[model samples]
Target: MSKPRVIYWFRTDLRLHDSPALKVALDLEPECLYPIWTWDPHYVYNARVGPNRWQYLLDCQNDLSSSISKLNPRSKLFLMREGPTTLLPKLFNSWKITHLVYEKDTDAYARQRDIEIAKLAHEAGVEVVTRVGRTLWDSDRLVEKNGGKATMTQKQTIAAGDKIGNIPRPIPAPKFLPDPGELNLDFESQKPDIDADLNAPHRSSSDKSYAKIAGPNGDFAIPTMEELGLTPATTPHRGGETIALKTLAAIIKDEKYTATFEKPNTAPTAFEPQATTLLSPHLHFGSLSCREFYWRVQDVVDNYKGKASQPPTSLTGQLLFREMYFAAHAKLGFSFEQTYGNPECKFIPWHLPSKIDPKSGLKTREYIVDSAQADEWLNRWKYGRTGFPWIDAVMRQLRQEGWIHHLARHAVACFLTRGGCYIDWERGLEVFEEWLIDHEPACNVGNWQWLSCTAFFTQFFRCYSPIAFPQKWDREGKFVRRYVPELVHYPAKYIYEPWKAPIADQKKAGCLVKGDGSEFEDGQLKLYPKPMFDFNERKDLCMKGMKKAYSVGLRGNDPKVIDGSWSALFSDGDHPLGRVEQKTRVDVDEKVGRDRKRRGQGTLDNVITKKE
Candidate 1:
């Protein structure tokens, strides 16, 4: 028999280091090997990727191509344009491909896409090989070990992981590569219907990414931001295997930090050199392997004499969190993204909820703008005009840069969902998907649920004080100053609550905290919006709503929730409980007295008593 003719498909894994899938492809010792990346239209048009992620992807592809060229001058990642489902079979037959090898992608859409491609490969009589390398253990296997249930918590993830064998060590990249066969793609291209484009909002110019079967230049070149008709990316985070390996080397060198690293203790305000290893984006693009990160950190803990942090909060614990989300998400396919039809997710009637896809019964990119107030608040939150400086600052940082600290994520997510705005977590999840350079579907969706108290976490009463939480990490408001520069000159006393500053003090700061968040300016003050709503009132309202929902105890998949009858069980204003009215200070005092009688302690309403 002739030697194997292989096509090494590059998808999630974009790096040369510690790639088990790449190692297996190399071990085949093929006579000819083609390292290729199909520029799938699904991502280009269907996914809600923004300019920052697109730029990062291009950077990774270019870097990987250059690295491959260095190993073997004749071999590099051959780029192709068109849907992978259509492109792969044609290439298989045309190039006389025998084996098609790639890393396993357990993402819901990816699994479906892979199944379609595998069936096509079988029809063409080409052997398709895949390996699980995205997560430490296969997400599917983890789910199976957990009795076919979602790993909802860190403890559950650890329990399920124990059944799976110890994670395999990293595989070294090949020193050399076999040259690719004849590169001639002379076939009719099934150009994606641009009318169905989901990322049309990002495109100011016409998208030319899928203009040709082999990209615009017709040499299978990586497309640029310009080619995709995207605005210039504002993010400082760059992606490449070369950069990722060096980062891991530095982190591993700091054995003390590596051994004792705790996620909770990490300062959310810290920057310049970020608090945590900003390797999440690297991990997302598979520029670095999860197994490689896990073991190196484990080696540090094993040898260190000092007491080290353990799972659920340790540096290794973060990996387990990722795995937990992956397994949980894999367990419930598309429904994992939204509360609807997800048994694990508790049904909450949030304002500005996600629009559902009728055919597939999944959430769409669009959301139902049911409440104008919720819509305006969401718009304000996204633009860093949320009145509260800490929340505003984090949102600004996220918008300007593609990354933010994890706790900062919690603050914004909590503020958006259960704590402040009473908006849907899915809204925030979609925004993260568009902006975060390191956004992983499972982690993003799972985290949103956790923060919203919709699933994983049941602490509806626990809310991050946008003011107090940031103050804990940054008492002087240095982080707020950096991102929300307008509030820079405001005193630390009033930085978190600039609207509360005396009018005379606001003048000294060269700004007045005014406006209703919907408008930009007031007179000559360059007015920042007033607090969107009474934070305490909103918090109290949400707490009451959450408790009521918990009492009902209906899951998203419940017949009542799916049939819309769930709405009848609760009221819709600010809280499921009726609203309180106090026309005067006397009335307020009386209400406070009645409140003391009703409960032992007053709600968060007393935290900041006055309205903005």
Candidate 2:
């Protein structure tokens, strides 16, 4: 038989170490190996990725390319610029590819995309080998073990995991790699149109990454941030397997920190050296294997002489939460990302409702600005000038650094959705989608639902006080002061509520707490806006709205929700209301469906985010 001419596709898994798919590829003992990254246009043009994420992705790809070269002098990560759907078939014939392999991705888009690629491979008589290394166990198998239901809770995930036998151990990377076949792209490149680019807002120049099939150099070189027309990434955190392993080694070396670590006990305000393990971005990019992280942390817990923290709160618990989200997304598919059309997500009448695509029946990235006040509030939250220093600090930190502590995430997410602005959680999720370097769709969507009291959680009345929450974490207001420098010199008593400080104190602080926070007053260089609204009043209003939503007991898959007439059920007395007029892309289309069950079992059933 002809020696296997294998093409190893690089997707979720970027690192050489602990890569199950890479090991399977090497086990083939191919005469030739081609490690390639297809720069799919789906994310480049359609997704809401910001500069920070783009830069981080490039960092990982370049780092992997360098590592691959180090393993073999003649080979590197050959980054081909084209959609996998169009490019793979051409490459197969051009390179005489006999086998294809990649790490399994269970994301809705990825599943569909892979199916198409697998079909192409089959038609060309190419054998395909796939391995699941992104999570503890195959997310699909976890869901199947749970009777094909979405693992909505950590308990469900744990039960499903227990049934799935043991998680796979890490495999060692090959000491040497076979040389790649002759590089040839004799086919025409099919470049996607950039008309409907969702990330256009982040770009300051025209994007030219798609100008050539092999990244302008014709050597399959890694694309730079400049090639994508994005502004320079401001995040201080970097990405690479080298960095990921080093960081993990450091954490494991400190046995006390690893064995006794609890998520809740970590201070959200801690920065410079962040309070918790900042390995999430590495995990997301597949530079760090989740299974590797899980086993490493478990090993420490087992060997520890002193008391070790337990799951749902322990380090192992954190890994399980990630697995839970992965399983939930695997089962629910595309609808899992939004409240609409998702059976698992509870329905709530939130401001800035998402614009559902009539043809696809899925919510688009765009939103209907039904309320001007809510729209303005979302802007304030995004730009980090919400008048609440604690919330503003975290928001600013996220934008500038592309990350914030977990509790810090809880605060900002709650404020954006049900807790404060009464805006849609989708809005906050979109911002995170753009800004988070470690943004995993499953975790972001799941956590948003939890924080918004929509599905995974239901503690409507228990809200984080913007003033109290951060004060509890940082009494000196260092975090708030660091992010919100306008109030850096303000007295600690009024650090969170800078507007409450006396006028002289504000002046002495070298900042004025006045105006609407967008424009400067009297040409003042540093002016902080007053609180957007009375926090006490907004909190009470949000609570009342949540109660009404709870009483109605509707879900995303409900007929009323499909038609969106669910708004009528939420009376004006339930919460404050307003109207905003702007040039929106799509107006609200009232399409009514035959009402199914008007009530849901979720009504007063379980409160997952019940202030634990």
Q: Candidate 1, residues 1-612: lDDT per residue as tens digits? A: 798899999999998888777888888889899999988777887777878888888888999999999999998888887888888998998899999999999789998899999999999999999998899999999999999998898888888888998889887788899999998776777876665766766777988877777777788888888888988899989998889889999999999899999899999898898899999999999988998899999999999998999887899999999999999989998889899789999988787666565566677555554455676787778878889999998998998898999999999999999999888898899889888999899999999999999999999888999888999998999999998887778999999999999999998887888876545555666677788888898899889888888888899999876656676676555353343221232333454456455533432122112221
Instruction: Give lDDT tens digits, candidate 2, residues 323-382.
Output: 999999999999999988999888888887777887887886556656657767887788
Model 2 regions more than 4 Å off:
520-525, 578-587, 590-612
lDDT of each model, Cα atoms only? 0.84, 0.85
Best by lDDT: 2
Using alpha carbons, what is the TM-score of model 2? 0.94
RMSD of each: 8.6, 6.7
In candidate 2, which residue pairs clash?
457-609
lDDT of 1: 0.84
The alpha-carbon deviation from the true structure for residue 579 of candidate 2, after best TM-score superposition, in angstroms, is 8.9
